[model samples]
Target: MTSRPAAPVPATAPAVPAAGRLAAGEQPVLPLSGELELRPWRLDDADAGALLAAGQDPDISHWNLFTVGSRAEARDRIARMHRRRTAGTGAVWAVAPRGGAAIGLAALNDVDPADGSAEVAYWVLPAARGGGIAVLAARRLGRWALDELGLRRLTLRHSTANPASCRVAEKAGYTYEGSLRDALAHADGRHDVHLHTLVAG
Candidate 1:
């Protein structure tokens, strides 16, 4: 993929704990309009079903390449998210609306605290697609990463074929930078990507 230039960052991970862990008191909470909240993935009763649904979605599986095949596998994947957070590389969150199941995910990947930059991503379940949750959730996470984590910038890129994701990136305030021609190799083949970014003042 076309890598975004890094912005300078402190050489330490933010002391923010995420949801579901016992140290959740330090978890950062991001509230969105219409009552959606982004929190750390919990090892709660719903974790199995939630992650299974995500893994089973044809769209999610197609895009992610590595999808969970069982509840155990789902748990393991989430554990890796937690480990990444501890290592100060990345963080993932479950998108929870008021009185609803965690219906989507918002995350920062390839985080570089030393560079003060990260890549933001989000996805909504098929059943949840029409609600515009993706844009709101992604915007919330980007803001949190910039504000709470003291990041200098965030990059968001999507395959050129995914127009819906491009819309989400634009609406989330990431300005289109340019295209990365055949930057990523997916299950189907290499794909071009549209790169977008939002820089902190």
Candidate 2:
């Protein structure tokens, strides 16, 4: 008697590799419109000055929860930024004119290369505000993160009270997903956050 045919084995879904998408390397200077660029933070006084200024600016301090009381602290923060890149956990860039001191910052925080996702964040100095620098920098960084780095999703979250950031997120082509209740804590108190996202095409 012929033996009964064996049942077919069910195919299993392919597993995602545990390797990280980002590896330690020389971070490239990403170009923005006409002389503006995003470069890695340097351990120089000028870059530290930018961080100090941001920490001191009332709006930036309030929104970003950043406070650098001294130049040394700012330098230490810059060093940490580099270390984050090396660790594949974050990528921070100084937004500036070619060969000039940074006037703003753009960052990919909480980067999970295995998951292909990261959060986008930025802040422009008072002098740089009102010129659409934040929008430009955000757009350029999003492109780099999605197109160049192969991240599947980029999230941008801001306190619900920050209309300017909402505008920036919109202009940068991020789609608003919804609000997150008590998602972020600020100097004032806990705040609800608006979540926006950009996905790779």
Candidate 3:
């Protein structure tokens, strides 16, 4: 038998989602209560003083996973967040209360539209922690993700040492899904993590 040439392959094609289904695109700024707004981050938001202070506060330091060193670095983070939002993989919202500075932050990440899932995280200034704002922000974001973004599940992960986050999850209606033993890498060593989840109805 004679040998035959193979057919040429096509160039890399764009990702094709299943018919009638598609990845969630960029999420727009979502609003919550009259006082609290979940809004897109502005460069000026970083200059509000609270953003840099939260990065330095022990209670909220976990956000500085790589240790942002200066106000400029923090401002750079806001810029990065802007890009992330446009990319549709995440969002960083300034938790601004009416007539006040942006005193906290909330966000969604690891957005997987194929899996209909995403991860939620947040922080409040030490001075902003007691008003149940974290819980409210988490709930607002979670609802919007499940209802508007078409996500089926949302997860919340935190170190076991951070009991405050656990309370926030509970108040936000996330069920405790047990711990991932020593799964979190920390500056001091490995730490056990609590995993929580909220499934859409």
State each candidate's clash count: 2, 0, 0
lDDT of 3 by residue, 76-189 (tens): 988898777666677788888765688788888887766777899888888877989999899999998887667788999888987888899999999998999988776667
Write candidate 1's Cα lDDT for 4-111 as tens digits. Answer: 989887697544323322223355767889788887787662454778888788877666664777778777877888887776778888898765678899889887
Error of 2 at 78 (Å): 0.7
Using lDDT as the yardstick, the better of models 2 and 3 is 2
Clashing pairs in 2: none
Prediction 3 TM-score vs. true: 0.82
TM-scores, in order shown?
0.84, 0.89, 0.82
The deviation in Å at residue 163 for candidate 2 is: 0.2
Report the lDDT of model 2 for residue 201: 81
Collision pairs in model 3: none
- CA shift of 181, model 2, Å: 0.6
Q: How many pairs of residues collide in model 3?
A: 0
lDDT of 3: 0.78
- The weakest ten consecutive residues by lDDT in model 2 span 13-22
